[model samples]
Target: MPTSQPTPWGRARGAALGLVLVTVTAGALLGGCQQGQQRQQQGETRRQEQALQAAATAQRRDLDALVERCQAGQAELVTAAAALSAAEAALAGLEQRRYSPLPRPPAPDPAVLQRYSISDQELELERHQQALQAWEQEERGRRSRWREEQRQERQRLQARLQRQRQALSAANPAVLSPAPEAKLNREALAAFRSCKRETLASLGS
Candidate 1:
């Protein structure tokens, strides 16, 4: 037996159904692609966030280490300053003693003077002058030596202070801030700024 041919309306309905199926399939495929793109974008955003977080953490650790070093340098500076002050005081005392005049000897009685010297007091005056000269010579030598020692001490302390200052400057958080070209999120930037402020305050800079 021969099968009956489909009517125009039936054929049209079938075509419409096929078109709908095609449309639905296309729509599903497009939706899937959009969803995949969205997921990929989310993953990228997560990665960027993670990287920013890690950078911030590293920055904090670096700041902490630098601050520790700066504190240690400051302590060393304090010790050096104390030592310098003591050295200066000692030098000053030596200077005062060196400059101080010796006590003048009282004049001898008339009887003793006649027995020691015939008429002129020039002999006694010469002796007194010679003694003063000798004392001054000795004192000048001591002062010169003390001055040299003080100079050496001062130079040593000054060098130590300079080194400490350089160390502290190197450890400055502002100097150590992240690169300007770095892509950081708002939260990470805020964290970095906060850390810098705290570090500066702790270092008393």
Candidate 2:
């Protein structure tokens, strides 16, 4: 019987070793898995052992397809998890200072400073400093009243992010899983990595 598939292994043969159907015959492939073959070949055999070999050979192709599907699903989950992590990091880095870091009040202008004597300059500096400090303190109080305003936006983003995380986890809790295990050919591995890269790139990262 001829090889069969949704994706022809012939096309991927060059890209993936030992993953091609056309390049490797069934007998050659089965030879590698022959531990109990000696016993099976004895005692009233009707080529059934070879039939089982062909069955296994066909099953392996099916397995290869499944491997690709598993990897693709995993790759999408990985990409989404990376995005959520980035969002969390950005949220943590949000500027949320309760006390407004008002800049140091500007110094007396150059022309004005040039006209003042040393004593006068000292007196002016002291007055200006006191005045700026008092103004800044009051300004901070005023600003503090509205500090939580931006906080509301941050909270909204956080809540939305949390909801998204929960929904995604509900869909596939494997996102938080330990080290993953999935069989992959060379092309499939490359495809999986490329999926992640394209996802990040689409997000403008």
C-alpha positional error of residue 171 in candidate 2 after TM-score superposition, expressed in Å: 4.7
lDDT of 2 by residue, 1-205 (tens): 9877646766576567665554587667677567357556663375777788898788667556645554557656556556566666767766543555656677788689779999988888888899898878978887876676668868977876675566445434533332232112234334344444443233222
For candidate 1, lDDT tens digit of each residue in 1-205? 9999999999999999999999999999999999999999999999999999998898778777755654555554444434444654655664555334455455445676676755456677677678777877877887788778777866775565444434433433232234432222334223333445474545433
Error of 2 at 23 (Å): 64
Identify the leading candidate in terms of TM-score: 1
User: What C-alpha lDDT do the candidate models reach, one value each?
Assistant: 0.60, 0.60
What's the TM-score of every candidate structure?
0.42, 0.37
Clashing pairs in 1: none
